[model samples]
Target: MAKIENGRKSVDTRSIRTISSSHIDDESSLGSDSEINGFTSDRQTDKYGFIGGAQQYSEESAQDVPTEVLRQREVKWLDMLSHWDKWMVKRHNKVRLRCQKGIPPALRGRAWLYLSGGKVKREQNQGKFQELDSQAGDPKWLDVIEKDLHRQFPFHEMFVSRGGHGQQDLFRVLKAYTLYRPEEGYCQAQAPIAAVLLMHMPAEDAFWGLVQICEKYLPGYYSPGLEAIQLDGEILFALLRRVSPIAYRHLEKHKIDPILYMTEWFMCAFSRTLPWASVLRVWDMFLCDGVKIIFRVGLVLLKSMLGTREKLKACQGLYETMELLRAIDARYMQEGFLVREILELPVTAREVEREHHSQVKRWKKIRGELNFKSPPRMHGARFIMLAEPPRRQDLQQNPTIVVEASQPTPQLKKSKEEKSKKKKSVKKKQPIEEIPNPYPLLSDPPPPPKEPPAPPPVSSEMPQIPQQTLIDSPQQEHPPPTDLSLAKESPLQQSTQSLSSTEQDTYL
Candidate 1:
C-alpha cells in the first residue's frame, strides 16, 4: 500500500480499486441503454436538453443579453459572411470583437466553418470525406473509437439511445478522421470535439471541421505523444506565474504538475469542464482567435480559483488543489461573467508566442533534441480569399467613366465650330419654312420656333485647353477593362475567380 499526503491527511492509493478491462468494456457497451432507460425522457431535461434537472446557472441567468441585441449581432455576422475575405484580410479586429461578444447561436456552426476555414477546406477537398467514410478504417483505431462513442455526451438526447443516428454519425466522423490521418489515428479527447461539431453541422462538414482543428487551429494536440500540449503546459505555467503568482506558488509548493489539471482542459477545449453555454462561447472565441483563447481561459480559471492568499489557503496540498480545479464553482463558469473575464485578461498572442519560444529552447537544452514535429499553430482562419466587396483602391482605379454632355472633346470642338460658322452665314439666307402640319391641333398654333441661342463670341485663338478624351486616351496605353463581371457576379463566383489555378484545382 502506498500512502500520499493530502494536506492534514494521508490517503492509501491501494484503497482506490481499479475496475477491470472486462468490467469497463461491459459498462461501455451498456452505457447508452442504461442512460436511455434510467433517465433520458423528454420531461427530465434542462433547457439545453441534457437529461438532468434545469441547471442552477442557465444562460439566461448568466446574463440576459437582449434578444434585439443578438438579432442585430446576427445581422452584422451575415454581412461578415458575405464579405468574409475582406473581413479576414482587412478588418480582422472587427471579427475578433464580434467573436468576443459571442457568436449568435443560430449562426454559430456556420460562423465556425468560416472562422476555422473549414468551409474552404471542405470545398477544396470535395468527395474526400465520402471516400474515407466508404472505406473500413484500421481495426485497431476503430475499436478504440467504438469504446469511446457512448462515453461522449451520453446524457444528451442525441446520444441517449444505444447505437442511435447521433452515435452512428459520430462514429463515422471519428472513423473518417482515422483514415484521413492514419499516423495520428484518433485521440479520446477528439470525440467530444467532434460531437460538438456534429451537433451543429453534418457529418462531412464536421469531419472537415475536425480536420481544421487537428491540422491547423490546434495542431499536434492529438498526436501520439501529445508533445504540443506538453509544451503548452510549460507555456501556460510560465504565463500563470505572471498572471497569478499566488496560484503559481501554491502549485509549486505542492510539486503539482500542470498536466494533471490542464490536459483535459486544453485537449477537450473545456467542453467537458465549462457549462454548455460557456463552452459554446469559448469555442466561438477559440475558432475566431485560435489557441490563445484556450491559454487565456486556463489562466483565468487558475486566477479566479487560487489567485488570492485566502483562496490558496484552502488548497493546502495537491489533493485539495486538484479537487478545487476539477469541480470548479458554478459561479465561475457563468457565460457572461466568464467571457467578460477572458476578454479583459491581457494574454495576447505575441506573449504566447514569445513564451513558446522560450519553453522550446529550454526543452531542447534539457532533452538534447525535440522528439515531436508538428505544424506551426495557425492564429485564426486560413487566409483564403473569399468573395469580398470591391476594395476602395480597386474602385478608385476603375471608376465609372461618365462623360458629361457639356464637356466636348477636341474632335467634337472642330465639328461644333464648323456648325456654328454655317449657322451664322446662313442666318440671313435661310428663313424658317412652315409647310402644312400633318396633325394640326384645334388649340392655338404653337409659338414660332425660338431663334437658336447665339454662340459665345469666338476668340481669335481658342484658350489652350487640354483635350479631354473619353475612350482611347493617348496617355493611357490600355484603358481599364469595363467588364464589371466581378461586380455583377455573386460573391461565390468572385471568390471562385479570385482563387489561383492551384487553389482552384485543389479546392474547386
Candidate 2:
C-alpha cells in the first residue's frame, strides 16, 4: 500500500514514469516529456472502454435490454431513415416516440446526422470543411482548444493517449470550426461537443455535426459572453418554478444561481455529468426533440434531487445544494430511471418560450438593453424544413401515356378529310381527366380528391376505353406496395436499398 503523507496518499513519481514509459506506443505523437507523464495507467476499462469512476455499462445494464429487441429497433430506425423526409413532414410524432424509446447504439451516429441535419448541411456545403481545415486557425482559439483537448473524455481509450489520433481529430474539428465561424471563435464547452461527435463519425462529418449543434440546434450557445446560456439559465429557473415549487424555493432561499450548476450540464449536453450510456440516450432525444429535451432533463434532475422537504433538509446551505447538484446520486443517474423521469416531466416548448419572453422583459427592465446581437434560438429540428426532399415534378416527369379509342365501324367512317374533322371534334368534346398531385406544395393544403366522372353512358356507337387503363391510372388509389423479398432481407440490406445512391455516398 502507498504511504499517506499529511492527509493525502502519495504516489511514487518514479514508478508512475516507468509504467507510463513502458506503456507508451512508439507511434504515439506525444512530443513533450511532461505531456508523456499525463498518460493513464493500463487500468481495466468498462465495456464502453472508459477507465475509472463508476462503470456506466455492466452485465445488468446489458441484460436490461435484450439483443433481439435492439435488433427490432435498428430495423425500425433504418426504415425510418429510408423515409426520413416523409417522416419529418407527416409523421414527426412517431419519430419523436421512437427517439424517446432510445435509438439503437449501432445506428446512433447516422441517426444523429439525420436528426441534427448535419448530413444535409455537409451535402450542401461540400468542400467547406476541407477549406476551413486547410487554413491554420486563429492562434488564440487554437491554443485554447489544444490545451482542452485531452481534458475531453480522458478516461476513454480513444482519447487516453496524449497527442493520439482522437486528440488530433478533435483538434482538427474544433480548429476547423473556429475558421468556419471566426466571430464566435471557440468556447471550451464546444470541445466536449466536438469530441463526442468525433467519437461516432469521421472528422469531416463530426465537423458538420458540430456545425448543426452550434448554429441550428443551440444557436448563440457558445458565443463569447455565453449570453444565450445565461438567458437559458433564467429560462430554466423560471421553468423550475412550475416543475417543482419545493426545489425552486430551496434554490431561491439559498440564492443559488442556475448558471453556477447548469452551465456545464447544458453547455456540454450532460456529457460530463451523466454516465456514458445515459449521455448517449439523452443525446438521442436531444437531437430529435431539441433544446426542450435539455430543459426537461434539467428540471427532472432538480426535482429528483431537491423536490421533497426530506431531500432538501440535507441540502440546507449553498455548498450542500451545489455539491448535491454537482455530484448527483447514482440511483437518480441510472439510464432507465432518468429517462422515465425526463419523459414524465410536464415542461413544454411553449412554456419555455413564454418564460423566455418573460425573462427578456425582466432583463430589459433591470439592465435597460441587451448587449449582444445573437440569432434567435431554434426550438427543435426545424432544419428538416430546409432540407426537404424535392417534389415529384422536380424529379423526372411521368411519361404521358396516350390511350386510343377502339376503331370505329366502317359505316361510321367517312371520307379521309371528313374522318379527320370528326376525330378532332370528338376529341374537343371529350372531358380530360385531371390527375390529382400527390406531392402538394407545403404552403398549400392538397385539394380534395375529385370523384371520377360518371362513366359515359355505354353505347354501341361509342369506342370503349380499356378498363385496365383506368385501374392503373395515377388518379386511382392503390394500396402501398409490400415486398416479400424486402421483408425477407435483413435490416442492413433494407437500409442499403432504402438510402438513395447519393445519400449512401455521404452518410458516413
Candidate 3:
C-alpha cells in the first residue's frame, strides 16, 4: 500500500501519451524496441558491449602491424626473458619486487615472460614449445573448457564480446597450448589463462607461458587423470586454511566446496574472473609470489563466500553455487580482516602432504567405488554446420549471423515504442504494447507505406570471429558458440544487457 506524495497521484502521464501517439500513426520504433528484447534473450558474444555489432567476430587489418611492432614485441620479450640468465638472478629479484607492486602498463607483455621465467626457459631450451605444441595424443580438455566458456565470466567484455576477434584469439592461444602440451591439451581452464596472457603479453610470449606450464611447473595440474585438477583443489583448500582462517571457518560451517569454482581460477590463471585492468595486478603477485597466490586467491574467494554460506548450501545445482564463490570480492576479503581466520588453515608440509596423499589416494579409491563423470570431450569438427569465412568488414567488426528461427514474430501495427531502439539511451525489458492491429497490419501496405515508414536499421562496431582448425588433427571442429553475435536480438536489448556489465549512461 504505497501512498503517493501528492494526493492527486503526481504521475506525469505525458511520456506514455506521447509514446502511443508517436506509434499508432507511424511505423517508427516498435520493431526496433522488440528487436532489442529478441537480441538480449539469445546468447551474444559481445556480452560486455565491447563491440555493438550483430556481426560475427573478425580481425581488423590482417595485413600485419608492420613487422616492426611484432619485431619490437619479439625482441623486447626475448630481452626480458634473457634477463633471467645465470648472472641475472638479481635482475630477476629486482623484477620480482617491481611485480610485487604491479607491472607497468607498457612493460606488461615483457614482464609476463620475465615473471613466469618462460623467456629464460625458451632461451635455455629451443624446439620446446613447438615440441609441446606438436606433441600429439588425444587432447583431454576440449569438453570441459567449452562448457565453462559460456559461464566463466558471462559479464566480462573480453570473453563475452559476441564471438569477436578477441574471443577467437583467446581460443587460438589456448588451443595452441594444448598442441604444445599434449598432456594438458585443450583444457577449458586454459581459455581464461590464455585470456589473462593475451591481455597482458603478446601472443608469442603467452604461447611460451603455456609451454612453461608443462616445462617445469603444473605437471600435476594438467596431468591426464583429471587427477591434477581435483587433487589440487584439495591442496588449495589446505593452503587457504593456513592463509585465511576467517574465510575457512565460515566455509567449513556452510560446507562450501571450492572444487567447482577453482576450475575457472586455476584454468585461466585468473584471466576469466578478474577484470582485465586488474589482471596485471593479480599477475604481478602471481609472478613474484609463485603458485602460492593462486591458492591465496582461492582462499580469498572461499572466505568471501562465507557470508552466503547458508544460501550457497541451498543452491539447487552446481552452476548457481559456482557463480556465488566467483562473486566474492577479494579486495574486501583480504584487507587484513581475516587474520584470525588465516591462523586456522593447515600449514605444515607434512600435514598438507598427508592430506594431499590421502586426497590423491581417494581419487584412485573412487575410481573403483563411485563413477565420477569426466568433463565434456571436444572432438574437432570442421564445417559441422553452415559456417563461413571471415570478411574484411567483419575482421574489424563482429560478423556472427543469426540462425533465424523457423517461426518469425507476428507482424502487427506500427507503434512509437519501436522508435526507442534508434534513440541513444536504449533500455531492455521494457513492456511492449500488446494491442493487435492498433493502426493497421497491411498485407501489402502501399508498397512501402508512408503513414508507417520503416525504422532505421540496426548496426554494430564489434570485431568478427575468425575460423580455425586444431593444430595437428585434421578434424575441423567449428566453434558452435563463437559464430553468433548480438544480432540475434534488436540493438535495444543487446545494449541493455550490455549496460548491466558497466556503470554508464545509455548514450546507447
- What lDDT score belongs to each candidate, Candidate 1 first? 0.74, 0.73, 0.46
Clashes of 3: 57
Native-to-model Cα distance after best TM-score fit, residue 363 in candidate 1, in Å: 1.2
lDDT (Cα, tens digit) per residue for candidate 3, span 1-508: 3224212122222222133543433422423221222224344443223323322221220112354565565554445444334213335454444454444455666656654555544555556555544543233444444444434343444444223334445544565666655544565555556666665655656777765544433445555555566776878776666665655565556566756668767756666565443444656655554455555556656655643445456544555555566575445343233332333333433454466667767767776532333332111111100122222222121123867657534442233445655453544444443222111112323232223222233335543321211111111122222223332444564344344323222211
Candidate 3 accuracy as lDDT: 0.46
- What CA RMSD would you report for each candidate? 19.7, 18.9, 33.0
Better of 2 and 3 by lDDT: 2
Task: State the displacement of the C-alpha of residue 45, model 3, in Å, after optimal TM-score superposition.
Answer: 16
Ranking by TM-score: 2, 1, 3
Tell me which of candidates 1 and 3 scores higher on lDDT: 1
TM-scores across all candidates? Answer: 0.69, 0.69, 0.45
